[model samples]
Target chain A: MPRQVRLRRHPVGALAADDFHVVDVPMPEPRDGEVLVRNTWTSVDPAIRIRLAAVAPAGYFPAFGLDAPMDGIMAVGEVVESLAVGFESGDTVWHTYGWRDYAAVPAGAGALGALGSLRRLDTAVAPAHAYLGPLGPMGLTAYAGLFDVAELCAGDVVWVSAAAGAVGSLAAQFAKLRGHTVIGSAGSDDKVAFVLGELGLDAAFNYKRGAIEDQLRAAAPDGIDVYFDNVGGDHLRAALSVLRRWGRVAICGAVSQYERDRPAPGPDNLFQAVANDLTLRGFRGSSYTDRMDDMQRDVAAWLRAGVLRHRETVVEGLEQAPEALVRMLAGGTIGKTLVHIA
Target chain B: MPRQVRLRRHPVGALAADDFHVVDVPMPEPRDGEVLVRNTWTSVDPAIRIRLAAVAPAGYFPAFGLDAPMDGIMAVGEVVESLAVGFESGDTVWHTYGWRDYAAVPAGAGALGALGSLRRLDTAVAPAHAYLGPLGPMGLTAYAGLFDVAELCAGDVVWVSAAAGAVGSLAAQFAKLRGHTVIGSAGSDDKVAFVLGELGLDAAFNYKRGAIEDQLRAAAPDGIDVYFDNVGGDHLRAALSVLRRWGRVAICGAVSQYERDRPAPGPDNLFQAVANDLTLRGFRGSSYTDRMDDMQRDVAAWLRAGVLRHRETVVEGLEQAPEALVRMLAGGTIGKTLVHIA
Candidate 1:
């Protein structure tokens, strides 16, 4: 028998552990053109909380039903059986049927906006779990967001919100690597220190301390050219205020509004975007899958050379996946949050 | 002595006729390298309401001071005296010293985001007041917003809010001229008729008749590719809901937010921008004066060829300039609003 997490009920206000539960199920067998994957590491991300809602935002992923298996999560696994021509037994692969011990995946199929493709992992580049973070969707998001979406130009002053977390840390480090001024903001002082000391950002601030506008202004006195937004709401408002002329904002995720029971109204000073000739673009890592190979090539080189640092907060055991999500959404976990199953 | 309109008080809620007072002042005389102009036609715009507040949105032009002449208003006049080498005494000039019978202006200096440069007008394009409407800032705003900011593409389904008003009408017509399917929305049924009948848009709707979302969805059955946002708030929310993948929004103005005494929070569903990979760009037309020659060439040709229709609700005298603004802001005027001085 294999086990998988199921949505117990839709969450209210902040997400809690009781919203999800793990249940045992029959072991999945690979059918024709399918492969049986034994899941090893599963990702816990802020976007999951959006699925926990009774109704997800329109045109986005649909809401998870109660008492049902949760899919569309990123996971790294090893194949035990293969009925597909391209896949072989004993190969390490990444799939989308995450939070489960076993998954039967259709060969060469992609889901979740083309991010979760059933593809073999290159262990020569990094470890299997790295696919769940920097070398995978996370890396692609940070790279495409900076170079493509925000169109990071030479001498741009960049600001990355949630700067100690998985995506933000990578985005901040990438900006620094490009020799641009990089400012990072996180929820806690410890995270802020990590961004400044470990990540080597030009400036760091704990948003819990004071006004985001004042802190951001202090970081980039002349004003920021690009804002990588992981937290919406007041963070977005502050970004709009501090962004210089022709500034661009890459709206990745809004952790500030995700777990809330009700949707919050967007920034009042969004009018500042017009006042300053700013562009606010919203995107998911999945939207830029075309640039995945480019991202992997750049990030893998950096990771191997020790130029791009990677960190993780691993929660042991499959049953604790819910807890991992709860902690990560609460900003209790730094860097990437993952569940490593034995 | 010359007469001018002065801001007697900051307008509250909706603007009123009494918010301004006409006063007699000493006639302006040309100094060395300055030109004296007898002002004729003055323009009324929605952005004036933004400045009428105690404080304008940050990074924008400063608020209009109480009991002061609004120097940044656009006007077309005849130069009566010139000490500047390039300008002759009888030159037909368009200037920024509006809402007055006389103005002394610097020869080539610019103000108000480079939009208020004193320059000669070519009445061969149409008439002096046409410089206040189709051949002026109104035309520039529409052109730059569609082509430069929104990045309008071929085969893009376009929606222009406030489509019967000054800038919106031009934006809608520009999109229509490019052979894209265009939808126009206005506050009243008669204005909707004008967009459909006179402007020849593919679809037209009165936004006040029903839910903006329902109306927009009905007008654009599949989805809109580009949104020219002249009216924000609910109209923006509706656009977010109806925009397809890779859609773009040019935040040209938010007349809905300008007249309100208190600031309104933005769309709750702006996250749709991310979900749909949408880009919302905010800009003022004055920022694109570099495109003025291009705009003048195209729009003047359209005006002369009778392809681009220009309409106006002209106030009889300068004393009614404030009333004209009030009417325009209230959606009581069609196309462009202007005060013609006798």
Candidate 2:
């Protein structure tokens, strides 16, 4: 019997515990291009909330049917019975299966084989959970934003919002490695200190302390050339004020106002895009999947060479997934929030 | 002592005739490394109004001083005297020496020479006003926005705002040439009729008559792939609502709200960028000035061969420059508005 978490009802505002329910199901055999995966761990992200409500209905995979399994990106067990040629029994892999004890995944699903390069993750570089955090899609979101999207070059000044989050921490390090002067903003003084002292950011500020504009001005005295925007709102408006002419903004996420039912009151400074000839590009790392092999090769090399680092906050159990998400959404969890199923 | 117009004072809101002053002085001769140009025509654009307010203090050129000549893209006469050896007597040219009766332009000051293939204007294909309209920066702005900035391709559907304006009209024709479906919106029914019935636009509407969203939805039923934004504000919000996934918005101009002394309302649908993975790039035609040889070459060729068409609203005399700008800002003029000095 497979125990599955099913979406019993659609969420309107914040998701409640009753939105989902755990149910038992019978296991089924695999098809020609399918493999049965025993679920280990599932990855939860804010984008999941978007999938639950918005987006074109026909374009998205239909919502967890009433009384059916809730689907998501999951780290899975070896293929017990595989019709697909690539897998055999006892092999550990990841697939976008669902909130379930067992699932039948078709060939080529999830973040692809891109997640498996962590098999050789070095303890000296980053813990295993860090791979799922800074070195995973979240980390890559920062990397692509700072380098590929913002095109951060040596001697440029970089400012990152949500500085202690999974993506922001990695982005700071990447900017530092590229010889950029880095600054960050976080919700608490402790996280600010972590970014400044531990991560070696040139400057860090607690956004909760004062006005975001004054904080940003104090952090980036010279001016900001690149901004990795994870928290959009007043923070975005503040960054716009001090941005250098021809500045580049890499918009990875807008977690600051993501939970709102209606659009938040964001900055009125977008006119700077014209006055300063600025480029504000919103990038989705999923679009750059073809470059994953190259990213893994380069990032692994960087990790081994002691040029990069990552951190994670592990919650031990698939059952704790909901709680971890709540903690993450509440801004209580630091670094990458991960589930370690045993 | 070139006769020039100077910014006497910044306008509080609507620009008045007293905002600028024109003075007649003896023309100066070219010195070392300089070329003397007899000013023939000057472009009156919406951007000039932006320059007058000193709002956007930082752009390609320095801001207009409290009391100094406003220099921008201008069409001028040949070097009557040659201190710059490259340009000799009677060589007709165009340069950036605006708000002036005569200018001692430095060598390579908007210097564009004819390419061998381009058919030089001989009062046959169109009027001389075409150079300032479809054959000059306005044409290039449309071309670069459509082909370079947006990377629009054939079969792609384009939704252009301010469709009957100089750049927008050229953009519609250019998109048609590229085999793309083009839709446009203008302020009045006459402009809409001209764009749809005369210019061969796939569809067009008068945005002033009704809600922009309803008009956009009806025009672009399949969704907008490329949106060349000229009129920002509610039009931009409407475009964002109808843009397809991964749509490209070429932020060419925002003439709608340029007159405001205070900043306008924020784009309410900005979150759509994340949802659709859209790329919004704000660009200016001046940055790509090196392409003048190429643009003039192609545009001139197209004009002579009747492969391209354009319109001109000529306001004769340098004194009428302010009136031309006023007309443009009020959206009363179609195609390019030029100040013709006799």
**Best of the candidates, TM-score:** 1
Q: Write the per-residue lDDT of candidate 2 for residues A51-133, one digit (tens) a residue.
A: 55544222223444556566555454556778777776655555666466777777664433343321223345444444455
Off by over 4 Å in 1: none
Give one digit per residue, the lDDT tens place, for model 2 in B1-342: 457777788876777777778887677777887767776777887877776666554443455788766766456454566677667766565666766777777764332222111112334534555666776678778888888778897678999998888899998888987789999999988899889877889999999889998988898888988899987788888877888877888888888777787777667667677656677777777656666567777777877778676777888888888777877888889877888875
Structural similarity of chain A in candidate 2, as TM-score: 0.87
Tens digits of lDDT, candidate 1, A114-172 = 79979999998899999999999899899999998899999999999999999999999
Candidate 1 chain A, run of 10 with poorest lDDT: A108-117
TM-score of each: 0.98, 0.86
Tell me the whole-model lDDT of each prediction, alpha carbons only: 0.91, 0.72
Question: Cα deviation of B249 in candidate 2 (Å)?
Answer: 1.8
User: In the order shown, what is each candidate's alpha-carbon RMSD?
Assistant: 1.3, 4.4
Looking at candidate 2 chain B, the ten consecutive residues that score lowest on lDDT are B111-120
Candidate 1 docking band: high
